[model samples]
Every structure is written in structure tokens, then in C-alpha cells.
Target: MERPRRPSFSELPLRKGDPPYSAWGLYGADDELGTMNLITPAVTRAAVAEVKLGVTIPLDLPLDAIAKPFIPSRVPYEHKLLARGYANDDEIRINTQSTSQWDSLRHFPYQSGYLYYNGVTNADISGAEANDKNGIQNIARKGVATRGVLVDWCRYAKRKGIEVSPFERREITIAEIEEIAEECGLEFREGDLFILRTGLVEKYRELSHEEKCAVAERTGAEAAYIGVECNEVSARWFWTRSFAAVATDTLSFEAWPRKNSEGWTWLLHEVFLAGWGMPIGELWDLERVAEKCEEVGRWSFLVTSQPLIIEGGVASPPNAMAVL
Candidate 1:
């Protein structure tokens, strides 16, 4: 039998077929996997070609790296060891999203329905106690082994003499993305995971506690985050390019408490997560991978992420790694 071809852009409104952002019926009515379905067999085969050096590096931050939890609500990771006779067991308690994490299908929404992917209402999430609905656990089985593309915007911007300060809510635009991709001579394909580097994690690690506090104060409402611009152009750009998901080395994928002048609040999240059912990775540790990519003059690689399979869980740390 022949393999199924992915739907094209002309096919809008998923009912006709799979549209640019809507994959509703394309996967199935009961499907919870979302854009991850883009990781087709052909795509996976292509990813293997990137692993020529056999070098591996982790893409996650230390769970307790931050002296203060940026998000006040989340509890810091705690480890407890128990000793019984000569045997000992350990217990680790942490907020799934305290460190590097993939925001699952249930992580965000405008209320229950004003916006949510595939008509997932409040009742749908509530009814499925064990997360028979869209849950992170659903994709945990696959463990996310596929092609990863790094758009080193920070370095690209610096080389171009573009001022990108980590201490401000600077919005990296779509034009920048195009420029960086062109500079790297990379053409993205469907289901490819995008890892955007803005030097956020690097600076955060370098700053003193007082300096960190100053930045947090200086950034104002959302805390100064360097990330992609939140706008329709950017959202459409990502959707049309067929990105499976996007990860960033920043506090939030977009600036915090982010809103465009046009009043599209968290537009990327509203579109990508709430509308398209795509995963969003935040605060990934990309220093080592970035360094490796620079040394090899290559950015794409075989990336893998395995999240904890917790039913009804909102988010989980990305046990993510890159093989080059």
C-alpha cells in the first residue's frame, strides 16, 4: 500500500482535508496528538541523516537552577531520600513546568471554549478525569524522536548588528526568522521541531540574583523576555511552514503578558495551542546544542523529547536531547 500524502495549503477548513492550522479531522475526531502527526515515517528517515557525529547533548535545564521560581505559583523541586535497613528510596516532588517543559494540550485556553483546539470545552476536560481528552500522556508513548531545526536568532542578530537585549521584551520578527534560515541555507519541512535561541537562558544563568531581580522589574508586566513577536503574520508564517511545534530558550515563547498593539493577546498561544492544538516548549537549555551547531556549521539535528506520561497533566519537563 502507498503512504498518505500530507494535505496542501489550498485545502483550507479541515473538513475538506487538513488545512494549514486545523488538523481536526485529519488525524481523527478522537485524536489528541495534534501537529505531532507531522512526524511521518519519511520525516523520521530524513532526521537520521543528521546524526553523523554521534554526539549527544541534553536540552533541559536543571530543575532547581533558578534560585527563585519565576512563576510564584509553582513549587520548586524537592528531593527526599528514605532509608529502610540498608536499602534506600528517593522521592522527588516538583512542578512539572518548573524547568524546561512542553506545555501540553490542556495547558492553556481562553476560558472553556471562547477558544480551544478541536472544540475541547471545559466539560470535555472535566469529564475525562483520567484525561481521555487531550493530555500530554497521549504523545508520551511516541517519545518525540524527529528532526529539529535551530534558528539561532541571537547570533544571527548580533552578526547583523541588530540590537537584541536580553533585559527587554524585544520581539524577534518573522523577517528575522526568514533571514536566519536563509543565512543557514536551511529550508524547513512539515513536522520539523523549531528550536529558537534568544540567549535568554544564557543571560539568566549569568546574572546575579539582584541583576535578575532588576531585569524582572525592568521588563514590567510580563517580565523582560526575548522571544518571537506575537502577531498574525508570525502565526500564519509558522502555520503555513508546517512547524510541528516550537521551543525557545526564553521565559515564554512570546513576551510575557504579551499583547500586540492590535489587542491580540498572546496571539501565538491563542493560535498555536488553543486553535491548532500544537505543543509549545519553553526555557529549554540550548547552550551546548547551540555551541555544537556552531562548531559543525549545521543547525538541524535528530532531537528527542520524552515527557512524563501523566494522565490529565497540564505540562511536563521535556527530557529532551539532541543527537548529532
Candidate 2:
């Protein structure tokens, strides 16, 4: 299906009675794939041209990369070996969000009204009648093969002699994002995955094992990291760019200590995931990919990812890779 031309940020809430800055009903009432609908056949065909070197850069951290998950309640990954006639089979269990993951439309909701994307209610996702509406399976079934634009904020800050502390509340403003895109020679396109490298994984590696575990112990307000500035302006920029999804190396896609939006880490989450049906990826290991981009003097590549096809699942690890 051909997607309609996106309306400007000023012309949001395309449907009457919907929240401001939302694109409800833009795809249709029963739309399961939100912004992902933008990943059309033409877009995928164009992205294939970006695979010049055939070098695939893995974007996922090991399922057990983190000794402890940032959310204390989240269970760490466990692998059990099953032996059968000298061969071994493994049974792995994990909290999808404990590592690199794609937060599906079901993960967050319109904070004010408790509505998910396309008006999916809490009961619609988890109750006696809960179905696969807005489930991660929707994305998995369609798959993701598109162009990915990398905005290396950490590298940009270093070039400008700025100290970027991933352990603190650092904000990358919209202006900075625009500037980085320009410096990286990128032109925003529909269906492009906006990838931000905040150097969080790099900093995480620098911490001692004890420090690493402690980092996960901190919860809520105590967790802080560098990330995109989350507000109406940033939301507008992302919507205008028409990104299929947005990913970051930071724990939170938006800056921590979310002092801007009245304690909400990102008001964009409401407008994007719950309102626009765009996915948000977090805790991606971009260190190596950033190095590869630098080596090739290019910031854009062909990215492919497949989320676990679990019906009614809220999120899943993005088995993602970039081909440059």
C-alpha cells in the first residue's frame, strides 16, 4: 500500500478528538504497523544500494551483555543446556528489553489516557480478550529492511572538544541533531532508521564489574545518561523526518532525569509510540558500527532487523545488523 504524504507537524491529530500532535487514523483505524508502514518495497529496494562493502555490523549486545538489567525487576538472561546423544540443545530465556531491544507500540501508551497506538487500550493488550493488536509480531511479520542514518553525537562532541558524560544527564538538542546530519552528509528520508550513538556502551565497558552491576541497581531518577532532548520540538523534528524508527546506544532514547516534561522521560514516547506507532530501540551496541562508519567515511547504511514473532509480545530484541 502506498503511504500518503505525511502532514506537517503543525497539522497533527489528523483525526478529530485525538490528542494533539498525534497521527491517529493516519494509516487507518485497524492499522497494526504504524510508521513501519513507511517501509515500502521502493524504500527497501533503495536501501539495498547502500550495501557496498558487504560487511555486516551487528547492532545487538550479547543477551547477557549486562550483568544486571537497568530495570531491577527485569530478569537477566539464562541459558540451559539440554543434552541429546552427544549433541547439545540450548533453552534460552530472557527479558527482551534487558538488552538491545525494540519497544513495540504495546510497550507505552498515551500517559494521559492509557491508550496505545491506534487507540489500543490496556485491556486490548492484556486481559481476558487481549489479542495481538499492536504486538511486536506485527513488526516481525513485516520485517525491517531500510536505510539507517547514524548521528554520532559522541564523536561530534569530541571533535568540538566537548566532554560527553554518558553517566550524566546530557541532552542532544534538535539543533545538534540537524547539525550532525549536515556534517555527516545526510539527507533525511522516509523509512530511514534514525540511529544515535551516545557512547553509552563504551562508557559501560569502562566501568568495573562491580560498577557495572551498581549501574543496573539504580532505578528511576537515579539512572542518568546522554540522549536526545525529548519535547514537542524534538517530536516535531522526528515526525517531519518520517523516520521508520529511532534507536540509541543509551539506556533511554531520551535523556534521563527527564526534568523537561514534568518527570516524563520523553513526551515523544506518547506522541511517537502511542500516538504515531513508531518503534523505539534502546541499549544498542553502536561502538563497532560507529567505527565502521568512520572507517568508510559514510554515516548511512542498509539495516535489516527481525524482532521475535511472539504474539501479544510488548517488545523484543532486534536481531539487527548493518551492511555497508
Candidate 3:
């Protein structure tokens, strides 16, 4: 079937009192119509498709690696019998400490006093039971369904013979991002989940403690790297375009660990989630997918991601896959 022509933002229908930042401005009146602008007809037909081509790397950091100098030796778990016939799995206990998972709306508090994408408030977010009632756990249950495009920044850097720093140290620019997309023969689609690969996870494990700290401190907030882009500008573009989410192989969505700014506050997390009702994925597995694309000389692939449906939980492991 010939695909529908991509619609313009002004063509979409706007919700009553919806903020100006909503993606509807990019397409037309209907939400589905706006979303269709971001996807190819081929991707829409198949709800679950592969987007990550790389081997799944272990996302958890070893407990010993993060042990503090003066902290007492801490055993991750100690089993106690709660029920005679029912035995608990140790993996469940261990998974609680997992840092590699995605965060649900319950995990963060908006400086503006709103909860998450749904505008649930702090009073609403207070109790565990309250959180369970309205949190990312329920919102994410639909599981991110959309087109995913991989922008291989590392490959672009290599083509230029410039060493791209690990995600912790790198700062990609909007222009550089556009360049990578151009080089890869890919175009940004509205409502698409855009994943940028920086090869940071692999390097994080290899760096010495001092080296890692130095890199982290340098990239904290003000530091800029070759591939890192400004979050505010990116957020504005994404919202205007009607993307469902923005993801990356980097630890934090921004350049690295940094102080929260207006852009980071209002745009990155607040506006996207609370205001626009969009989700953001981070610390994704993308290197292998990029490699596959390079090997096949194909920039396009089918992508799918499923997060655990744990009610009231903050984040879930991304069950992501990619097919060429």
C-alpha cells in the first residue's frame, strides 16, 4: 500500500487547553494522526519489531565496584522465612538494587510540584499505595510501541577519525547529531524513539576509579563533548515533532551527571513527561545494533522494546530487540 503522506504540525487537532508544547502542533487533530507522522507504514503494521542488534550486556554494576570507603560491609540480601511453603528467589532481592533499569514517574518529583507525565501531585505521589495507583508502572504497561531510529555517533566520529568520548565524557551537538543522521541516510520522524549510541557503557567498566571520577566530574554539567547536544533545544524539537520518547546508550540523557538547569528541569524531564506525557529511556543497549547496521550497510531495522509491567514500580529493564 502506498503510505499516507506525512502530515504537517498545523494539520493536527489540538486538545482543549493542551499546552503549546504538545506534539499535536506538528501534525493534525488526531493523536494517531500525529503519531503516524513519525513512523513508516511498514513499522506501524508490526507492533513488536527488533531495534537493537547487539548482544545484551549486563546492566547492573557489581556491588563491590560501588562500595564506599567507610561504609560497613553490606551483604545484598539475607533470607528470612516468611512463609513455610513459599520460598523467595534471591534474584528478586538482588534486582532491587539494580541501577540499570528505567525509571517510572514515581521515581522523580517535579520541582513544580507535579508528579509525572499525568500531572499527579506530591500528595498523590506520597504513599507507596498512592504511587501504585498512578505511576509509570501502569502508564508504561502499554509498553513503548513506535518506530526507532539509531543515530550512530561513534561511526560518524570514526568516519571523521575523531575519538568519541564515552557517554560520561562526551557532549554531542545538535549539528553533529544531524550530521550523523545524514551520514547514516536516516531522517528524524515525528513520534519516533530516537536512540543515539555513544559506546559509554563499555568504557565505564574499563576506566580506573580516578579516571572515572575525573571524567564524571568534568562532564558533570558544564562540560561539553563532541557528540553531546543541548537538552533544551532537543526537547523543544522532539515535542514540536511529536516523538514518544528519546533514548541513548549514555547513563543520563544529558551530557553526564550534572546540576539540574531550567532546560533540564522544564524540558528534559518535566515538560516531556508531566507536560507532554512522553517517556524517556536511558542507558540503552545500542552498540551491537550499530555494528550490525555497519556490517550490513543498512541503516534501517525493525525495533521493539518491552518494559516489565510491575505496578507502581519506578523503572523496568528494557526487553529490547532489533531485526535487520
RMSD to native, candidate 3: 6.6
Best by lDDT: 2
- By TM-score, the candidates rank as 2, 1, 3
lDDT of 3 at 193: 74
Of candidate 2, the 10-residue stretch with the lowest lDDT total is: 259-268
Task: Please give, for residues 145-230, the per-residue lDDT of candidate 3 as tens digits.
Answer: 56667778777777788765663345677778778777777876555777777766566667788765555454224443333444
- Candidate 1 Cα deviation (angstroms), residue 172: 0.5
Candidate 2 TM-score over all chains jointly:
0.96
- After best superposition, candidate 2 residue 182: deviation in angstroms? 1.3
Best prediction by TM-score: 2
Provide the clashing-pair count of each candidate structure. 0, 0, 28
lDDT of 1 by residue, 163-255 (tens): 766657788888988988998888898889998999888778888988765554543474666778887678768878887889998877876
Model 1 has an lDDT value of: 0.79
| Residue-level lDDT for 190 in candidate 2 | 91
Better-scoring candidate (TM-score), 1 or 3: 1
